[model samples]
Target: MKNQFDQKWLDEVAVVALGCSLPGSYPSREALLDAAIGAIEAGDLKVVGRSSWWASAAWPDPTAPAYRNGVVLVETPLPASEILARLHRIETHFGRVRIDSNAPRTLDLDLIAQGRTVTEVGLVLPHPRAHERLFVMGPLAEISPEWRHPVSGRTAADLAAAATVGSDAAPDIAKT
Candidate 1:
């Protein structure tokens, strides 16, 4: 029996912004990123574009290992729920465990947005907290500066700029 979330829709396109990070000891950033790309490819998601890694903002713990963050843009026909499910599966594939709300892990994949869709039950499109996180906005701005918040109508770059104010975490783009 196929999972309900696995059911496919036809010709739907979603502009997905994914924020990826790895905390604690694990595979090299390059390796983990490669794995993510591989997983997206295997899932038949079209790679629209991606941004270079950036230093992650310290949240919940400022002393944790520096995290490398980046965003990927994909065109997928999957529903918002299934897209989120796929993201969780990718996280699990990279050894993520749900120990706590913001615990460090080998991989963290967030589904930042699914076009204009929005829901708070199982998954939230345009991510409920995305507008306030530099980690999400920075890379997202790099690739999709014009991308607007569904609710606030603020562009990704605008959100990123606003988030930088008074932020102790100075995120720098990773040199590839």
Candidate 2:
């Protein structure tokens, strides 16, 4: 299920994965996401592709409010550290609190991967745990099914189907 976008430039630039989600309304998740995307676009990166917002139960706590999640593909020239710093700034600008881990926040931005680059230090590339989460892989598959994990070399669609985390994940019907 390849998306209808021309991804030929994928080889010409470094592709960075961006995961965005909102479990709490900060004037509506969609609005906040739009603004966040704009902010990302305003930076030194260029957003080349995106997945439609998907809805899923709050992980580890299904009783909590559902989350609207999506993945964006951006081309960047900055190092992985700077790219992560920019993401953190965007998350903070959107009212994201760092105290509670996974406790329903206004905005959550994650750097899932950056090209084939990998690091063992603080900021991990091709996110060490991303391969286990469908909420992340599902959207990644949606936009770039041909994407492959840098280490395992598995396609986005492959890891997405084999994903263990967030099995209940699915396309957001409310959006379509």
Candidate 3:
């Protein structure tokens, strides 16, 4: 029999992005993250764990306000597309308006991955470029160091240390 059967448990894990630079309706990024987590918990998924919120200078424009970013692991039976849809809805509720490529937003939620599903035509798995960003990989590594990239088979910790983007990213010491 094939070994490493524990990997099967990851099938139900859905990774979520908690990123925000604008306060919007909330008083602070922490409040926004809290509200987003509450909304997520109200969905079909069950929030299981989370990573430390990391701070990074805004991308494409370092002069802009820094961003607070983190990840959450949820257990769900929902498919990748459905999970993405739900995340978008939560973003809408948080007053996120899509304009510029990486404009500051109250909340930005992305379904980084759901289990090991991978697709190119629709919602891409492993978030396509997430592995190259420290902001994403770092937090993910904090929670699931061994989270494997379905395509490359690399662990999150490895990816985080090797990330090409957000070199200044680090776990927010004040928040953590």
What Cα-based lDDT does every candidate model obtain? 0.64, 0.74, 0.83
> Where in model 3 is the C-alpha error above 4 Å?
1-6, 119-121
Best candidate (score: lDDT): 3
Sorting all predicted structures by lDDT, with the top scorer first, yields 3, 2, 1
How many pairs in model 2 have backbone atoms within 3 A of each other, for residues 3 or more apart or on separate chains, i.e. clashes? 0
Off-target runs (Cα >4 Å) in candidate 1 are: 1-27, 119-121, 164-174
Clash counts for the predictions, in order = 0, 0, 0
Off by over 4 Å in 2: 1-26
Which candidate leads the pack in TM-score? 3
TM-score of 3: 0.92
How much does each candidate deviate from the true structure in C-alpha RMSD?
7.4, 2.7, 4.1
Return the candidate ranking by TM-score, descending.
3, 2, 1
Candidate 2 has its poorest 10 consecutive residues by lDDT at 11-20
Q: 1-176 in candidate 3: lDDT tens per residue?
A: 11121456666588887899988878889778888999999979898878778999999898888899998888887777778888999999889999996888889988778787665466678788888999998888887888887778898889999999998999998987
Report the poorest 10 consecutive residues by lDDT, candidate 1.
Answer: 1-10
lDDT of 2 by residue, 1-176 (tens): 23544445543334433333553455677777777889889979888788777777887888867777778888888877888889889888877888777777777877877767656378767677888988888988898887877779888889999999888888877764
